[model samples]
Target: MAADSRAARPLQKMFSEVPATYDLINRLFTLRLDQAWRKIAAKECMRENPRLVLDLCTGTGDLALSMAGQARPGMHIAAVDFSLPMLLEGRLKFVAPGQRVGFVLGDVGKLPFREGSFDAIGIAFAFRNLVYKNRERDKYLSEILRVLSPGGKLVIVETSRPRSPLVRLLFHWYMRTAVSFLAGLISGRGAAYKYLAHSAINFYSSGDLSDLLESAGFRRVQYRTFLFGVCALHLAYREGPGNMENS
Candidate 1:
């Protein structure tokens, strides 16, 4: 609650405590733009023509679902998160049977997968919860790169602070007051909503995070800002394990 160095457990506990309403609150807070954002994110990842994908921190499986929907209709996706209840809720969201999505119980920092196993890795609106200053952030990036195949891609979608003063004023007001109020009304967890707002503010900007990705052994790193600079999508490629060493 105080923005400490070790806030992951607190936030994880909060998400687990409110797993039933997490999806509802997410939609309310983002004013339904979250779905569209996921669609765009999925499209961006699919550009690499990845057949196998992993959605890290795939809360409620929205991004994974979008990836499955937007991809070449036969893409295999592993949607993973530590919260089982959230995955359960996501499973029920799909009305039809035989979806191509598989939900796995795992942590993003240490994935239970083999090296070079996936063609693409994605995380949407979930990175800030891990806290950028944490060592786990490095672990997340390392695992991401390790699990991605040669020339694989990693796309991270996160919230950003508005650069325009007028937009910042409106964005802050919406985040602290409107978003929190709606989230509280739907999920009965205004405190969690407040924590989310704080996290967004403290989260790194697109440029800063791109540097982190580069430092983590990713190449061709770049970022795309969206939603009036209130959101960003970071794209980077894994040059295959050991390939960089020889070349």
Candidate 2:
């Protein structure tokens, strides 16, 4: 827990500092594809017809907004992030009158919700930051599984490593050099962008992340790669109570 807190401090501070320019930097860095990715993930979450949805690590509420855009009437959407500034920014810009999306300040690793509380959960581009250590990652997955109802779904959108060696090499070079430099220049937070670039390069591959989700008690884990395998959308379901008990 101490180690986890240590890791989280840096991330929290970085996010808090960047909320003003976070969305702009994201648009620039991803060439506006980040919005499309979040939309795709939101569509997957809604396919389950979830009554209650939680968007964890919902930085600036992009995924939450997407989910609410297509949500059924009376559906509840709660978007949580540790950074209050980011949540506030999202609430001001993305939230519409009478919209279902509710922005909250909270941590994903230790969600402030009851077991079996949510029917669907979505996380975008922020899973890598939760992986402070192996144990920390396990804790996050456990909490996510605990909160999800039986057979509920969790959708994850994140950067991925390519299988091809040549593509992997080029991807790493772009992330480490061009992305880091450009984001830092635009955001005026060079260290923060550098950390993000480093995290992307070191994050798990699609297959390995799917395995991790399965080990955390999720079943029917599958993923779709995009952008020459530089990004992926992972979908996994929590099995019924009997399967979860033995997990």
Candidate 3:
């Protein structure tokens, strides 16, 4: 994937400024439903007893921590993010002694791992950030596919637009107004939160994302919506050999 240094700098700075209150603000914004969402994602990712898991764009390592909680004795989780402050904060707050979750400083578009390294991968709420310019979305997906072992699973948790027209309108309004306002009040970063709100509203639908996964050589794509379709959890698998690229 082509690197966009311009976009990366601002994102790094913005995320760096909020690690202290990131978890608290997220809990407040999602009404604590974020925890349940992570739990479900963890459950889905761990179904195959993956030995090595990668959590991409793992801000504050919430999803990684959730997975580590129920993982097998030898399971190892590598949680990666571009922001050093976020990783440090996550390490300080969530990682306990002997925990297998390792927070790494890295970028999603350019993962630093060998091909077919991870058994499973998970990302929550941070997928939209990779698609800001629309040019890197496919590249990021390809990178994920490249690093995933054959038959490895990918679980994605992201905000989605509701199907009902009324609910969609209200959700958009809340994201653009209430969420931004409250996030600003809590983090003192109104503009950052506004950007986040806009990104979520403009992100592709669950069906579109599923198609993207298929195009990247993933199969058995399935998704479930939550909170009246305001969010979705997508599960997909990288087909074994004789499938597309590996074929």
Task: Tell me, by lDDT, which candidate is best.
Answer: 2
Off by over 4 Å in 2: 1-8, 132-135, 241-247
lDDT of 1 by residue, 126-202 (tens): 87876455657767778878898887888888897667878777878888777666776677877877788767766
Ranking by lDDT: 2, 3, 1
Return the TM-score for each candidate structure: 0.87, 0.91, 0.91
**Model 3 Cα displacement at 131 (Å)?**
2.5
Minimal lDDT window, size 10, model 1: 1-10
Candidate 1 clash pair list: none
Whole-model alpha-carbon lDDT for candidate 3: 0.82
lDDT of each: 0.77, 0.84, 0.82
As a TM-score, model 3 comes out at 0.91
What is the total number of backbone clashes in candidate 3? 0
Q: Which of 1 and 3 is the better model by TM-score? A: 3
Pull out the clashing pairs in model 3: none
Worst 10 residues of 2 by lDDT: 1-10
